[model samples]
Target: MSAAAPTSGPATGLLAVGAYAPPNVVTNAHYAARLDTSDEWIVSRTGIRERRHAAAGETSSALGAHAVRDLLTRHPDALEGVSAVICATSSPDAMFPSTAALIAGEVGLRGAAAFDVSVACSGFLYALAVGHSLIAAGLAGRVLVVGTEVMSGTVDQEDRNTAILFGDGAGAAVLGPVPAGYGFQSFVLGADSSGGPHLYLRGSALRLPAGTEMGPYLTQNGREVFKFAVRTLGDSAEQAMREAGMSTAQIDWLVPHQANRRIIDAACERFGLPLERAVVNLDRYGNTSAASIPLALDEAVKAGRFKDGDQLLLAGFGGGLSWGAAALRWWGGAG
Candidate 1:
């Protein structure tokens, strides 16, 4: 049987948003006590001063569930028709069971097609695309897409390169029908696997052996990833804008993954967008991997920075050497 095309039934877009960060906060001083880094140095380099870290036993699924629940709390009716749950995460609670399944159960989703999408920092955008497609295909009336990560669990605290750059958090959005011209207008998703070796985790179910000394931890060639990110982010954003027939002059807000402030600034500069238009929280949250975009989005929306009928561009790029961007017109407050 032929697969169904994405449904054109109703215009589907983000209907609600929620975000969560674990209460435990870690400051540059905390890392300074262990690593050979200072607050001023980290700030000057990565623009990060503090980040939230998940407490013991708090997994990515738990963070994600909290975020979804927060969304549901504001728009309880959102749960009434949820048909699928798409979780995007780099750090999962386990190698199996999929974090989406755990989150689905936690948020009272029963029998919904729940699964996880692993695209590293670009996860939210990737999951957003999948959620959008599901709604467009008419397979799901409503979908919950979440990007959550306990990056604290994945990094080696003693390693200055990766340790100082990650945090723990989650963000979620509910997707449903919206009025025409009010949702996603275009998307750009691409990958350059050749750069994958520059950033990756070392252990997995297949390659990891018992009694091995190599612990599961993230590693990165920062200079390589940085170069790739700046170029890819700009390219992805421009491509999406082109597809959407939008000009930089028309974009009201920019929400790019919060990897590094410098990267965000570079991409905005390439797009001819001023830094003021971008939503950035990396200084306070570090790189929460997949959770960064939605976390920033939720904060922006709640803070009244966005209004109805604003043109918004969301972009992300990271490991997998993957990148994605989407153009959407804001509809404002949940319906």
Candidate 2:
């Protein structure tokens, strides 16, 4: 199935991109020193050697704000007409007052329409779709979509299952008008709530009984998640590509969520795309949840990898058993 033709509306696209990882680095050896795992075991499983950790008192908002600041620093006029700030984060600083609002305030966008999306690792793509729609509907001209995570705060340091696979980072993209036919072409989003039990963070929010006990940490059934992610990611990519009226051969880059090396390889193989056509950085940053795609995109852009008019496929899946994908024609220039 091919995607519907581009709709007639305000042409919207990513204008710029930026990312930030805290200075603190945690190597596999850091975990090996405490856990029963070694560097070879961690790398062979997750393809991660080192990951960043947020410093003391650092929050998702702070990490996201840093990314926005970086974007603004390079593209000083990025916020000239930005009227909305949407942050996708599962590790929010607090339950109230959205992390987007905090980031907007920090970036001097005090009165912008700001909010948060809690779709886990698929969040950035979700926020990107929302930002794209906002522009298409003329609700906002320029919107900042950020995916920030302090996963280090959520993972149990003692739980090797999760602790070894997550890192803290933030990535932001400024969405605005681009030349016609040069932005987002189509999007696909889906979820299977039954898979929710495979990954979750059980906390006191559910209001347990007086004596009920809960583990206040991110937990997961790795085998279940691996199975679900591999299938959903490939399907989501095909759906998004079809919706964009393109075939796998037309895709110039595949930017999947940086969850695991095996999952990424499987998805690429399913698409019949070579590994070289995919943007991957999980080896250095592990899984930064929603930040993965944009972080990799930013790195690729700065490295002069994407050319103008490149067809890019962005896909992700995460904790809510949610997955999303988008097809876009890149115009380059984003850093």
Best model per TM-score: 2
lDDT of candidate 1 over 177-285, digit per residue (tens): 8887788887778777777777877646455323334557887889999988888888788778777877777888999999889998997787778889999999999
Candidate 2 worst ten-residue window by lDDT: 1-10
Error of 1 at 169 (Å): 0.2
**In model 1, which regions exceed 4 Å deviation?**
1-9, 205-215
Q: Pick the candidate with the highest lDDT.
A: 2
lDDT of 1: 0.86
> What 10-residue stretch in candidate 1 is worst by lDDT?
1-10
Per-model TM-score, in order, reads: 0.94, 0.95
Each prediction's total of clashing residue pairs, residues at least 3 apart in sequence or on different chains, is 2, 3
